[model samples]
Target: MVDFTPVPALCGGLLIGAGASLLLLGIGRIAGVCGIVGSLLDAPRSPDAGWRTAFIVGLAFSGLVGFALAPASVTNVANSPPALVGAGLLVGYGARLANGCTSGHAVCGIGRGSTRSIVATCTFMLTAGVTVFLVRHVVGR
Candidate 1:
C-alpha cells in the first residue's frame, strides 16, 4: 500500500498557490504549466514570454533538485517504462485537445467561479476515476 503524508501535500499546495499568486501579481499571467510551455516554444511575441520561459525552466529544474537533494523521499513505482511513456504522451495529447490541463481547469479555472470550468473539472474527475477503476480492477492490473 502507498502511504501519503498530508504535510508534504499541504506544502505542495502552498507552493502551487504561491506560484499562481506570483504569476497573477507579477506578470498578470495564469500559472498554467501547459500554457507556459506552449508559449515558450514559439518565437517571442509577448515581452512577458521571457519571464515565462524562465519560470518554466525553473519549474523543470525543481524536480531535478528535489530528486538530488532527497532521493529517499521519493517513491518509485514498478511499471514498464515504454508503457508509462506512451501513457504520458497520450495524456498530454488529451489535455491539449481538451484545451487545458487539470491545473488550469481544476485550480485556476474553478477558483474564478467559472461554471464551465466547474463542469470540466467534474468531468475530469469522473473520467479519471472510471479509468483508474477499469485499469486496476476490471483489467486486473
Candidate 2:
C-alpha cells in the first residue's frame, strides 16, 4: 500500500506551483519540462536556451537535494534498464503527441484558464488511471 504523506506532498506541490509561477512571471515561459528539454535539444544555440538549460539543471539539482535530504523517500521500482528506457521513450512520445506534459497542462495552463489545457489534463488523468488499473489488476504487476 502507498504511504499517506500529505504534508510532504503538499509542500512539494506548493514548491512546484511557486516555481511554475515564477518562471511564467519572470520570463513568460511555461514550466513544461518536456518542452524545455526538447527546445534545448532542437536549438542549443538559441537565445532562450540559457534559461532552458538552467531550468533543466535546476530540476536535476533539486532531485539531488531531495535525495540528500530524504534518501528513504526515493524509490526505484523499475529494476530493468530496458524497461526504464522503454517507459521513458513512451512518455516522451506521449508528451510530444499531447503537445505538453502534466506540468504544462495541469499546472500552468490550467492556472491560466486555458480550455485546451483543461481537456488535455483530463485526458491525461483518465489515461493514467486506466493504465495503472491495467498494469496492477489485469497484468497482476
Which numbered prediction scores highest in TM-score against the true structure?
2
Error of 2 at 139 (Å): 1.3
Tens digits of per-residue lDDT for model 2, 64-137: 99899999868889648997898889889888778889898898889899998999999989998998899889
Q: In candidate 2, which residue pairs get closer than 3 Å at backbone N, Cα or C atoms, i.e. clash?
A: none
Scored against the true structure, residue 29 in model 1 reaches a CA lDDT of 76
| Range of the 10 consecutive residues with the lowest summed lDDT in candidate 1 | 35-44
The clash count for each model shown is 0, 0
**Which digits, one per residue and each the tens of the lDDT, describe model 1 over residues 2-50?**
8879998999888888878888898687776776666666546778778
lDDT of 2: 0.89
lDDT of each: 0.79, 0.89
Model 1 score (lDDT)? 0.79
Runs of candidate 1 with Cα error greater than 4 angstroms are 42-48
Error of 2 at 87 (Å): 1.5
| Per-model TM values vs. the true structure | 0.83, 0.92
